[model samples]
Target chain A: MNELSTLANRLAEKGKESGNGFPFEVNPIPGEVEVLQIVIEDREELPIFISVSEEQILCMSYLFKQDEIKSGKENEINKAMLIANISMPLSAFSLIDDQYVIYGSLSVNSSLDDITHEIEILSDNILESIEAMREYLN
Target chain B: MSLITKILTALRGGAREVGESIVDKNSIRIFEQEIKDAQGQIDKAKRDLTEVMAKEMQAARKVENIQADIIKHEDYVGKALADNNETLALEIAEKIGVLQAEADIQQKAQASFENHTNRLKGMIKKTTKALADMERQFIMVKTTDSVQKATAAITDNYASGSSKLLTAKESLDRIKEKQADLEDRLSAGEILQDEFDGTDDLDEKMKAAGIIEGDSKAQDILAKLKAKQG
Candidate 1:
């Protein structure tokens, strides 16, 4: 779809802009979707990633492994996760098979500004959740 | 029947009997060779399947690419016709037709590859599953044979006076007793330890300071002893 490619090209341009504080690189995965790896410079972990499809833009990033947490800290961390989930606007915190990851999506109909806003805040959701659980996370 | 024809039929029957005997003798070897040949064919089919899958992917991409080009070109054609550029519009329409035909050919190729790959996949799956079943059955038989031998060996060991089964339980009990003894020593041995604690001894300090005296309980007064002597 032209809309999809136009969106990809726009993202590619955004990825090149200096001092945008949202540095990203385009990774072409053939026949499926276009993936953009966005850097969250302040947080030292895996890069935040976004995927483009014909219908929507998907964003996600991994926070930590679930198994590394001890059972004693589960109750405290779970309480914080619940609160973060309720307070965040578009992103939702989800546990994915021994790893904690946050993810969100926006419709392609949204303007580029709206898409960028969702992506930047999707990463913020992960950072804030991690910072809140600093007592157990760090 | 005539005598010569009957003789010929008898000779033919004898030859058939000899051939049948030879075939019976080598049936197992012949069957094994056939199985090996079938396996080679299956391996070839699997290899060809990967090639077909690759072609399918390329063909599918080719179709999508041309389809996108056609859409773009058609939009241009519409614009040209709106601008009254008859020559450009006709040229663009011709190009669009070419792209459409090419896309159709690629779609056919994609379909052909899909069918070929699916057939090969089914064949390979069937052959692989049969081979796996055969291997499983062989392993089951071999396991049964080994298990019977092991059972016999165990029976013989128990029947003879040489078996260590009786002593194993006694050794376990001995180990438990030793463990219990070690645990008791661990608990009570703390009090019997002769090493002095690192802290200063209050009683020894008091005696050295003359607040208490050697060979005299605190109740025995030094003043009474002095009075008696005087």
Candidate 2:
């Protein structure tokens, strides 16, 4: 538990350095497992919730603004829809042992393509770093 | 030269004879002795007045001395009272009163220095015994210790109990953080909807199963599931 907290603190520091507002909070409920909630800037009031189990990190659900959906172009909204659809599956992949996920949604005004591309690249780098750590540990 | 004139002449002759007898030597001697006796009586009265005057002067001096002593003692009593030594003040005051009473008694007694001195000594002895008793009581009270252990014990208990509560609260804070994390996950949709949906169903199921006592247990099971996954 202490190790997990230290890792979360380091991730928060990195997020702060990248000019992203660190809006993550760790909460634990007795008889329940610990969860990490991250709210991204310019996103709707609904936050992304991640549940950390002994074995996996689970993506429970998401909430979105109806106005944000209606105001954007069909193509833009489609891209956002695709991202939302892939959110759970991607989170599941990142939940596997030694995998770190850096996930946040962009505002409607922002291009999803750019955000998705950045996330993919960042994920690759994070995966590579994790692999390196695994090799070093072994 | 009538008969009445002759009677008057005879009376005058008798008065003249008696006067002649008084003027004789023996009569003169008796007069001198009576004059000496009067002189002795006057001398004795003068001596008695002088002795009485001397005694009055001595009594006045004694009264003045007693007044001075009383004044001095009163000043001491005043100072003791100011210092909050009421027992000592009272002792001094009582001594002064006794001395004053003795002085009054001496004034009424026969004018004898020895008698006055003896009375004064007796008064001094009585006052000294009274003052000693007061001193003994004061000493006893000053030395005895009052119990303050009960007060200290209560204060110690409170301090220890407060410390225990503080430690428990600190530990409780850790569990509180875990509860907050689960709430956040539930809000963020990180957990499957079915899990929480199942929580509501469990509540109903517990009520139906005649397991009212197990309701909390069931809730605990749900919370544990949420917390474990989180």
Candidate 3:
């Protein structure tokens, strides 16, 4: 038994020296779809979110420029959401069963109308995210 | 009473006494012969046991010597490996492996011989017990009959058998030692390598000979040699 232990130790040391490393802390999820969460300080600089299962960047969302949100027409928020939806292949987010939610607030100085428009825009983006996810599943 | 009646009675009495004496003498002779035979058997058994023990001891000594040689070779290999001379180290390692295998084989043979010796010893013990019992019976008969026998049966049996047993044992011991020496030499590479190498056909030969399954190393070696020749 001691001899076996010694051999195991030697092999482990060899493996470490070879520089092959595992990246994620894999855990068993309750349901079929795997989950990944990323937190950022500022929504505008949203980093690319990669799905661990599919090996692709699934979502990229950034805060809209303040001037465009203010000067644009009423449907601008929905347009921005639609653009974000079309940017990525639908297959990228299929691993997420729940609504793919993106949470961020408008700048404090922005008007009530601007905040409302941003919320609407975010909702449109959510719908587009769900549709993209469905396409991927099919 | 009449004189003729008295004379007839006296003659009958004398005849009866003579018959009783003859029967007593025959019983004594038979008992003595039995003791002699039992003693002879004990002697033979002792001799056989001695021979077995001597062989066992000789095999043991040879095994010890081979073990020492193996340790030395192993140490040499370890030193070579430590010195980073991997080529030399590997060569020594291979040699050590072969020597170890030979030592293992000899050890097994030694164990077998020891077991055989033990069995022979058990037989000798039983024979000795029988002889002792026979002696006791003979003494009981002598006391009851008031007969003085001339033969020192016990002493003669022990002396003759023990001496032969000792001599045979010594001879077997020497033979075993020689066998061990030959094995050691083979391990040390003193024997020709070809002698060990040519035994691959052993299985085929064993099959042909109808020796389906048994541990006959000598036969295996012969078979291997034949295979190599072919």
Candidate 4:
């Protein structure tokens, strides 16, 4: 019924047309924005979460769990994250509790192409960081 | 040869050695020429790669076109045989046979060109990678050689003039002596900082921590009110 719902529907339609085969579902959240979850391929059960608002659209993928992040390797993890952030196209790294997430956002004025590109970039950055994190972490 | 001529030759040799140490022109020239040669090679390789790729593309297109022509002719041969013109059909069949032979030859040529192009691509990639590595090494060595030559010139000049330059140890000793004197002067300056003037240390510390004498507009307003009342 709102602008974000319209946008979300269009985004899902575009995904269908694009034939990327990412299983996507949209769920409404109370008083803020609807969430769109995409099952990221090759990431083993960790899904990319999407939230859309009037100001910006955000995509986040929970990359590593607390136990998956090796103990006493915060320094190496931070350094690798910093470099990956620098090299990533449209995605940035963020921390939530003990979870490592690749977060990407764009202004609401962005076209469908831009949103697709940002999501693609975020997914690629997440996949690439997994290898480096393995070496850096225990 | 006369003794004077021999002496002159020795002096020229010594002068050349000095020039070599100062400029090292010969080595620099050699390096420049080598880099130029490498650049020329890469350029030629690039040009050849383009030509080879163009040729491969042409051959591939030729094969595709011939394939289409062969299919069309086979259909025509069928139609001609159905139309009951046996002689014309035989003639068409012969032409088709000739076309198939030409097509087979072109297909072979296409395969050959593809292999040749792939080999050339691999070779160019290797040569380019080697040249890149060589360039990096050359830059490092050239920079190091320049630094070494400059240092040598300075040390040589110092050797002919000062006792400190007699050996590296003496030069280091001289440097240390100067450093010590500079540090002594600095320490004298530092000694003044150690002397304390008597003051209310607690007051200053409290002020620094913003726990004493808050600057507020409330105080100014209160003063203004009292003055107005008076």
Scoring each candidate complex against the real one, what DockQ results? 0.01, 0.00, 0.00, 0.01
lDDT of 1 by residue, B1-230 (tens): 64336434543453442112212326445545656776887899989999999999999999999999999999999999999999999999999999999999999999999999999999999988876665444433333233223223322333342323323223234434665886788766764453343223766787788886755764477678878999
- Tens-digit per-residue lDDT, B93-149, candidate 4: 888898889888888887887888888778778878877776665654453343333
Index of the highest-TM-score prediction = 4
- Where is the poorest 10-residue window by lDDT in model 3 chain B? B146-155
Candidate 3, residues B29-82: lDDT per residue as tens digits? 887898888788778867877887788788788778878888898889889888
For residues A6-111, write the lDDT of model 4, one tens digit per residue: 7668767765664774534443333222455554333323345666543457777656644555677777788878877877778888754344667887787888
The runs of at least 3 residues in candidate 2 whose Cα sits more than 4 Å from the true structure, single-residue gaps closed, are A1-138, B1-20, B24-27, B106-230
Check candidate 4 and list the clashing pairs. none
**Cα lDDT, model 1, residue A29:** 32
What lDDT does model 3 reach? Answer: 0.45
On lDDT, the stronger of 2 and 3 is 3
Q: Sorted on lDDT, highest at the top, how do the candidates line up?
A: 1, 4, 3, 2
CAPRI class of candidate 2: incorrect
- Candidate 4 chain A has its poorest 10 consecutive residues by lDDT at A25-34
Off by over 4 Å in 3: A1-138, B1-30, B142-230
The full ranking of all candidates by TM-score, starting with the best, is 4, 1, 3, 2
lDDT of each: 0.63, 0.44, 0.45, 0.62
Candidate RMSDs in order? 29.3, 51.7, 56.8, 26.7
Model 2, C-alpha of B145: deviation from truth (Å) = 99
Give per-residue CA lDDT, model 3, range A69-136, as digits (tens). 33334255445455654464332211111112243333324443443333334433433453433222
Error of 2 at A103 (Å): 99
Predicted candidate 2 versus true structure: per-residue lDDT over B1-230, tens digit per residue: 64336434543454442112212346345545554554555455455555655666677677778888999999999999999999999999999999799789657643664454555455546555555554443332221100011112222332444322332223234334555775788777856677788887997887889676554778888899999999
